[model samples]
Target: MPRAAIEANERMNLRVAAQQKATLMRAAALVHADLTEFVTRAALREAEAVIKSAERIEVSERDFLRILELLDNPPPPNEKLRAAIAALPRDR
Candidate 1:
């Protein structure tokens, strides 16, 4: 696909060594996707995991207590959070 085919999403080029490229190409072909599509999907999957891990979440005593409380008596819905989740992509 060309630049014009891509939507208004943030994008950039990435590089890997020649040997790595050859290895990835073989893997991609085995899975029935071209090099570009294979690499892009793999990289973005890892990027999402990294972003999730970077979120500020701690497992301290207070956090554990809050979790126990929630498990004991779950809270009602927050409309804002529900709307945010509903807006996410369903195509996976």
Candidate 2:
């Protein structure tokens, strides 16, 4: 979501070294945003990127092909799988 579109109703407090605060303030000014807005946007963006990276899967071409082959030619059900399927409700 865009920073301007966020319905901010909570408060967050942060403390930084003087030089760091000055740098943040200058950067915020350069972007025509307040310190809180700039920091919130940056932090949210990074947090989203971290989450997205965690949820993504990267497999080599060989692994991908193996997965596709398994799907296309799945093995027959084992005894346990057959028992589990037999136990399912049959009302449908």
Candidate 3:
């Protein structure tokens, strides 16, 4: 979604300690932004970072090679796995 669209239609309310509010206001001033804009931008940036970290998988080269090798030379399914597959419901 576009930033403008995201910002245009949302309302949020927050409460903070005086010191925290002062700090944020000061930082916002230094960046020449209103308090709401500064807080929104900072919150959005952190939110995106958190979501990206959660959604990403980081694998080392050795592990990647190992995964590929496993795929290429997979072991035969064991009895338990075969039983699980057999237990699965058939599609209509």
Regions more than 4 Å wrong, model 2: 1-9, 75-92
Model 1, TM vs. native: 0.51
Segments in model 3 whose C-alpha atoms lie over 4 Å from true places: 1-9
Worst 10 residues of 1 by lDDT: 1-10
Task: Please report the candidate that would top TM-score against the real structure.
Answer: 3
Can you write out model 2's per-residue Cα lDDT over 26-73, one digit (the tens) per residue? 999999999999999999999989778878888999999999999999
Per-model RMSD to reference: 12.4, 5.7, 4.8
Better of 2 and 3 by TM-score: 3
Off by over 4 Å in 1: 1-11, 56-62, 66-92
Model 2 RMSD in Å is 5.7
User: TM-score per candidate, in order?
Assistant: 0.51, 0.63, 0.78
RMSD of 3: 4.8
Expressed as tens digits, the lDDT of each residue in 5-75 for candidate 3 is 35565688799999999999999999999999999999999989977887887899999999899999999
Q: What is the lDDT of residue 34 in candidate 1?
A: 100
Ranking by lDDT: 3, 2, 1
